[model samples]
Target: MAKKPTKDPNYKVIAENRRARFDYAIEDDVECGIVLQGSEVKSLRQGGSNIAESYATVDDGELWLVNGYIAPYEQAKTWGHEERRRRKLLVNRKELAKLWNATQRQGMTLVPLVMYFNHKGLVKLKIGIAKGKKTQDKRATEAKRDWQRQKARLLRDRG
Candidate 1:
């Protein structure tokens, strides 16, 4: 029998960067801090928090994540944080400088991969450095993925 996928116990996904996979070839990943308001943090824990439309930019010696959405906390009072505000991403000086340099080149981008709570129960963001893929590259990737899936299915049947 084919083994089923296992879910991690500490798993709680706040957001996913779907376009990152479709558009870019991720080269390196980094875990960074997310500065969120109290209400935003509360809402994220309740689920449906996603950064699908988000992308990263470095400016003024800092990294920013724009277009991320954290829903309003239902129980929170007024004066809540903005749902689609640009949030700061924490990274060391060397990484920040490197990202800025990489972004200066054409077709390279910084994209969010996932947002989840760590073992310490703090929210974290997984960022990736990637280069954009062309239309033909996308098609090739899809074909390879389909072939792999079919191959796995045949192997399982034989076993």
Candidate 2:
């Protein structure tokens, strides 16, 4: 009997921006749709996009995603889209207005967290409205994380 071939795991990652966690204290999060070109969507399905450096901005009452990186697919015959193009976020006018109001406070900014496809195969972006954290604040967060890890280790040893 012939053995069946092993198939590669299927994971269609749209994008992810890791920097949002380290630099900001997130206040609220919103999931919104992404505007995409045909080639851009094709590239996204192939995987490996970066949203870690990307940010969301409200300009002229529209929401824009900046610095998101979606790489070109290797097998595509035609031209792939630019690596780091600003993509418009597809949100309703009222939603954008609300987000705009929420982000207008001092030290508050809109940041993209992760871009992934839903079960229905629609692309979605997780955006957060956050306040920039101070250096001491980041240090304190790190200290707390370390303490938690140590406490977990101690509990595991005892139990």
Candidate 3:
């Protein structure tokens, strides 16, 4: 038996968008901080948020996360935040310029890949610059993934 690779202890993942890979060809990944309301942060701490259908867009030179769902905290009844509100993303000027240029000039998109808390306990979003995949491309990706799984199983059994 072999020990699995040690996971990083500094980051605690809150949610992931597994479907993003199936729908788009990811090009580059960028980590950016999120501007969250106190109630929203509390809700995320309790965990059941979804970023699967969410996307990031640059508006007026600012990046905003759209369509992401962070469930309302039951305890904060009066201060609960909107479940699907557009949250602002914090990126530096250079990265922002790069992302904006890629999306506008190259027809790329910003998709949130993972939301996690860093060692400092600050919430962050890992977004990817992606291009949409066609149906044929998706099918081929699925076929390749299936083959990899089968190959792994065969190797394990033989060993």
Candidate 4:
């Protein structure tokens, strides 16, 4: 018998923004619920969504996700969602205030890190408070990563 792959309660990632780490210095992370249309939810389940170019914004005392691309469901013709529609994010007032304050600071912005299904099977977006990294900072980050990889390889070979 083989073990079947099951959705883990911890997290089942749907889409991830790989470039986020390389482009920004992440400061804080907050998991937020997303308000999705009927067709959008189905499209996300089918697994072709993209959050790589998406970001979160505070608007009129609420949070909104901008530029995330959830492809229209193929089965739904006229009712399909727009590919790049802005979706509302569900966060409490306190959390929203924190994000709003942080975003008001210089060099700080909100970026969506990943979208995942939580333990309750609800879709969530993990947004980060980040600062744009300078060219030198990016180079330093790459160097540190390279060194870590080299160290791990050397340790494995010696064992």
| The best candidate in terms of TM-score | 3
> What TM-score would each prediction reach against the true structure?
0.89, 0.86, 0.92, 0.92
Assess the local accuracy of residue 62 in candidate 3 as a C-alpha lDDT between 0 and 100: 99
Error of 1 at 16 (Å): 1.6
Which parts of model 2 have CA positions greater than 4 angstroms off? 1-13, 105-107
lDDT of 2 at 7: 45
Q: What's the best-to-worst order under lDDT?
A: 3, 4, 1, 2
Q: Report the alpha-carbon TM-score of model 3 versus the true structure.
A: 0.92
Which 10 consecutive positions of candidate 1 have the poorest summed lDDT? 5-14
Model 1 lDDT per residue over 1-159, tens place: 999967666667777877788889998888899898899888888885878888899988889999988888878868678888899999999888778888886557999999998767889999999998999999999999999999999999999
Q: Of the candidates numbered 3 and 4, which has the greater TM-score value?
A: 3
lDDT of 2 by residue, 1-159 (tens): 999965434434566666678889988889899898777787788786888777899998889999988887676657667778889998888888878888775547899988988767888998998999999999998899899999999999999
lDDT of 3 at 24: 96
lDDT comparing candidate 4 with the true structure = 0.92
Clashing pairs in 1: none
Clashes of each: 0, 5, 0, 0
Error of 4 at 16 (Å): 0.4
Cα lDDT, model 4, residue 134: 96
Which lDDT values do the candidates have, in the order given?
Answer: 0.87, 0.83, 0.94, 0.92
* Tens digit per residue, CA lDDT, model 4, 29-90: 99999999888888888887999999999989989999999888999898888899889999
